[model samples]
Target: MKRIFTFGVLAVALASTVVLLAGCGGGGEEETAAIGAVKVPFWHAMGGPLGDALDELVLEFNATHPEIEVESISMGRYQALSQKIMAAVAAGEPPVLAQAYEAWTGELIENGSAEPLQGFFDGPDGLSEEDLADFVPGMLDNNTWDGVVYSFPFNKSVRALYLNKNLFEAEGLTRAPATWREYEDMARRLTKDTDGDGEIDQWGTAGQISAWMFENLLIQNGGQILTDDGKHAAFARSEGVEALEFMVRLLTKYGKVTSGYEYQNDFQAGKVGMIEGSTVSLSFMEGKYTFDMAVAPLPAGKQKGCFVAGTNVVIFAEAKQQEKEAAWKFIKWFTSPDVTARWAAKTGYVPVRMSAIESEAMAARLDEVEGLREVLAQLEFASYEPRSAAWYAGRKHLEEGAVEGALRQILTPKEALQGSAEAVEAEFLGVVPM
Candidate 1:
């Protein structure tokens, strides 16, 4: 991880070019009472409605707290934001707060780029017991490392099946499939060559195959990504093979899914029946689709499952005490039930705190949204992706192998997954289970 983050002089110079002064406050016990307003620069990857919602929150926070202001910076996408964060950290000028993926949290911690937030959690001005209890189970704990909390959940999301009800009705289906086999059967039935050209005009389902998707299927099939001890890769077992084979068979046998963004575009265009996608799609699909859309929990295999996504806010250790305090204030306010609920309602992200979901305001908002209830229900079965420094490297194997085995048919599912496991073992760890 350090090797990947070691920027050359040119990279450092480039990072310097991107630096901007964030805040106006100064710190010292003597000057504490007279401290000026602090401006916190927050780097985030969200765009569209999600970004708008974040900006709204920042505006509200700034209005209420005259002593602190938040400046939201858009970094395009998560990948671009992540790369910029690394470069910024290497340049010793990280934002006081930035959004981070779970795997990125591991990297940041390992590189000493992030500050452990346990002190804030346990401090006098920290979260109250009632506040602590408000968070959904595992949501807050997912950000903890070695018993220390290091991050706070921001725009979290889980997988949900987006169904076009008009298309389902055309197929004589009244509801979404409840099991894997049923889903596969429906996928085949819904696939169509409407123009008599023998070319598929409508697909039943489509989603990018990545480690997050693989992990969802693996867990749904009663398989784990790693052993209990977390020392070795364990997704090469029979259950894992079943998961891999099922996804590959969708393309090779049923020929339902299209490659790349075409599937999503098709779904938006009302040419696709259903899509396995994140709840965040709600924001993306708003006011644009031609069909009546509904969402349902993912189909079950050995068990119901899906992967949670979105990033968390992590403060930088390199920040001054005043800035850190100001950043913490923003983090706390952002995660508070009322504020978090407002954000979740405006965007499609899940509310981290249960109290937020149960709030009267949130209840009213959920009643207005078409598919949000189903998304919240999925939280019961969703799990966070693995947090590991090696995840960045190991993840590439699955992403590439998914294309090789599923779409291109260059290898069998087992061979592709096995090759991925072996590559992860050789490159990231020593010996994964075969």
Candidate 2:
């Protein structure tokens, strides 16, 4: 949906030190397969159930394709993994395949640390036309920048509204909120002081004022994060203020929501009636909540909109021909319709392929899963994160703006946004706002 508001905008790893370094300094337009079993070092940030699911897929792939062996390594988290990868790249040693975000992809591209996948895709051993057509509409496109595809979607997830069905039923609300006003009203209704204490014991919702959440709100408020040329900030306008205003009001005015990561714990403990989080959280949340949990698309503001996040698989430019070939093979196998469908089912990520999502297998799997359908449905209205390297710095400024307005109350929403705009423009575009 097109945003309805005015001027608003939106928005690792480390591994084996020695072995990683030993596999460096080789690159070519075309990859050649090795005769023996080729070990592809793959780095990812997923842990717990998601990590287990990834390992299982690698095992399955290796079992079927004996010539290709994938060595999957959990790098703790995305930030840590990213730093380690960059260090490895600087040392002329990097993994054969690794999970990365668009921001990272932008950096890697600029540094010539990542390989463009366009050639591979158009090559003889590439995905067939039918296979390419099977991908979710925007999934593949999201990985492309400047007509070159540098990565493929992996472990992508969309933000979803998680509702406490029991609380909603108690309030006589049979369905999730559909708009901003409805969400506010429901939030107010759900908030309570159960023990008659002066302080409220339960909150209507918990909010995370991150760049991604801000971007979703900004777009929903009918604003764009950057100008058409992608050289200036555009989100500090009226629409931006309105978006931030809405977010701030939820906490400062209505007292419907609390800030911080504690919301997840609160939601599970039944102290918060609603929480918006990634689809991947479902794997960690399963059997953890005490109440009947339900998922729904984010409530629309002027229109329905969302932002999809998570990493994409990128082959380091330093990888050898054989390893590169093996990496692409693993990438292809991992993102295949059936494979991605099973991955989604097991790891709580949204499947990247339309064919997989609509397949009978996915249908059956969704039936067994509680909230998978709602998360998948969000793809229809989602947008990709900013693909420019500028976004890496811009995101921090955006987060600061949100914090100033929503948490600290140090600045009005408009002031916060304007300050953020100026900071981002100066830092990234090297322009000072007048």
Candidate 3:
């Protein structure tokens, strides 16, 4: 909420330092037949309060800039955005910027649909080498490919367990779980069908069981999900089987939670005692239910892990010079220490800049929640989703593959994991490393 951007209106004076300037120059570029206006389209996936906040940000951008115009269109989450983008590109109208996941970002750059923005570091008043150091360590590496940073991380979310404090207290549970075994022990105590209807009326833990979530949990349990190269699947190993067996035990043995209810809805409605989801869940959850809510870090395994989740800013390859410059200016403010501090405080996505997270504002906000301090502490051990085309093109198959083994009582945990791993391996048959 703090305006760290000073309105000096300094023109981009230096050119060569500007790394990705395919078409840049302040007043030196050729003028179009149109007068003093450039249209830059953006596609983003956000809804509810955070979406409203983004709309306000777009208005702020429009109000401040005279030469460039930004239009942020809503494209739903991963599934919806991918469909919309594919259709738009086929129709010859891709947006200037996109809000996509790390997997999608990798595919965009691989398909020549996106360009690296690292040159922004060298441009006139672009991100400095020191500025680069201010960023949260794992963010850029998550979105980068082949030695180049492809996406500019704007907002980030990480895995966290949103526990219903009232429920925990009612069940004599005083604290959140720190390790997988602890989580399992607590979940069993919390699961009970109060009505004796033979069906579960309450659950101790819930989440969408998929490959990525599998990777998140498995890695937490001392497992390696992807190969060293980041292109191949490595889930068929002992580590992978151990991870799947752990989750399968949750559904089959513990009976903590069912998969039918939407993750946030059930959590917010009070039927769910514990749910793991994006930190952005806080935005929708503001003032919803007045219960003692506290956040716990994603439970750790011997390996220690949580996936970095968020959107990044990207400039198109042939965008207008004025548009690119304007975008960079907004990005500078968006990613700055003070601005990101306020943003993380308002929206719940952890700031991707280390300085922003440490700023006094964030510290004060943490003092208020106090419980979230552990989540911030978990940043030191976060991991990235494996970047790949198969991940983008065929994540659902993996999801179904995982959910199948997890929900059914028929397959042993090892059997489920082996089948799921084989399925993912089949999908990665011909991926050439970049």
Best by TM-score: 2
Candidate 1 structure quality by residue, lDDT tens digits, 332-434? 9989888888888778788998878888768987776656676687787677766775655677777786535655678877787788788766655553321
lDDT of 1: 0.79
Tens-place lDDT per residue, model 3, 360-408, is 9798888877478788777787877666766554456556765565556
lDDT of each residue in 380-410, candidate 2, tens digit only = 8788766676766787888966555555678
Q: Which one wins on lDDT?
A: 2
Reference-based lDDT, each prediction: 0.79, 0.80, 0.71
Model 3 pairs in collision: 17-122, 18-123, 19-119, 220-301
User: What's the TM-score of each model vs. the native?
Assistant: 0.87, 0.87, 0.83
Badly placed stretches (over 4 Å) of model 1 are 1-35, 251-256, 430-434
lDDT of model number 2 = 0.80
Better of 1 and 3 by lDDT: 1
Q: Per-prediction count of colliding residue pairs?
A: 0, 7, 4
